[model samples]
Target: MAKDELGYDRIVERQLRGVAREVLLQVGSKGLPGDHHFYITFRTDYPGVSIGPTLKAQFPKEITIVLQHQFWGLEVTDEAFAVTLSFSGKHERLHVPFDALVSFTDPSVKFGLQFELKNQQVELQPADKPAPGAAKDEAPTALPKKSETKPAETNGGGDAKPATIIALDNFRKKH
Candidate 1:
């Protein structure tokens, strides 16, 4: 197979993430059917993400918000989406671009989608806490440097793993 010279993975990731946005807009415009619900996790610091100060204080890094029963004014546009949700008896509107989403899951049918943020957008942070004996000045290991080689194929493989599609019946049976 000839080596690729283009960044296809990033393009595919962008497309897949757009699918999530379209699906959310569909469900939000038309009410959710049956027990289907969404748990969306996104980066709080992503550009175009607007949340109330209280919510920002509570979820300084990332937040997983549920879209089930309590939301209103759902609007979707070419670049971003805005929704009004109530918190602590006060309603707050949040505007999030499709690029900000990190993970989305519809647990009713075990369906999920994950995304990789652009290199410039991803935060460099340690996962595990330092050990008791670890030096304070020690830095967390950096991610492996990405190669400049092009992708071998447009699609990774003809038999690439399928995106998770939740069976409607599975959600129906749950409730």
Candidate 2:
């Protein structure tokens, strides 16, 4: 098969990231219910990744974080996800761009996604309008459109009140 000059081979690869992004957005908006959990592996050195010096020193190149019992402040955007996790008794926040992601897995459902390393930054298009009654506090420019991709299905039906707040704090640290 002839490779398309338009980088068509990478279309599915890029869509895979969108799939993972949708999952994270659901988890952020609706806390993981039952046995669902995620294992997100990402490149540490990618541009826009934020990690504490201690954790960065430990996993200098790449790290896998589990989202199961004790994660806080998960904010999902079109291009990236940020969450605060307990590490050595400290709540360390991490920011990882989807383009920088290496893999995402939901072992409980036998679902997983792996992305090829795309060194360049992936600019996110503005997300669709926020759901009705969504908090007005969020700045208009930073929101990621949620309707552009396949909607996450809920067994219970209808939108559930998000159990957690989508706090957008300390997204990236300046060097």
Candidate 3:
């Protein structure tokens, strides 16, 4: 195999991360548009990740967060993004560097991206399907897209209501 002297893989990774950063900046300022939301997955143990000890323990390897209704303090920078999320009624703040990201997805539009880390270097892959070893029970059930989510109308089917909020597992492509 020829040596990758120019390091195109690293360049591609940086570019992909930039895309995520730009998307985050847009959402941070304007918030999600229409039925759009985000499913952000990252390596919990990666350098520059900050989460409460409980969350660290629970998701020692990785965790995916949903940014729909319940998230707050969405601040994005060139390096990382920070936000607060509710986990089982307790609010927790998270700091995730773009380099630590495993994937990013907007299932409403059927768009996604996957990242690979090999020896601390980065590579990007299409999120049309999750990369190998990406499957795990990260959430209670598989995530829901806007159309796929339909909360039973407790108000006796009065009017159609959009899905309030859901996270990583809800973002999964239904098999």
lDDT of 3 by residue, 94-115 (tens): 9998988876776565566666
**lDDT measured at residue 102 in model 1 versus the true structure, 0 to 100:** 68
Q: Which candidate is the best by lDDT?
A: 3
Write model 2 residue lDDT over 5-114, tens digit each, in one string.
Answer: 77653666667788889988998999998888876767777888998997666666666677888889999998889998776556778899998876676755556665
Q: lDDT (CA) for every model shown?
A: 0.62, 0.64, 0.67
Per-residue CA lDDT of candidate 1, range 104-142, in tens?
667555567666776545553322322223232221122
Sorting all predicted structures by TM-score, with the top scorer first, yields: 3, 2, 1
Model 2 gets an lDDT of 0.64
Ranked by lDDT, the better of candidates 1 and 3 is: 3
TM-score each candidate: 0.66, 0.66, 0.68
Clashing pairs in 2: 127-144, 127-145, 128-145
Which 10-residue span in candidate 3 carries the lowest summed lDDT? 134-143
Give lDDT for model 3: 0.67
Best by TM-score: 3
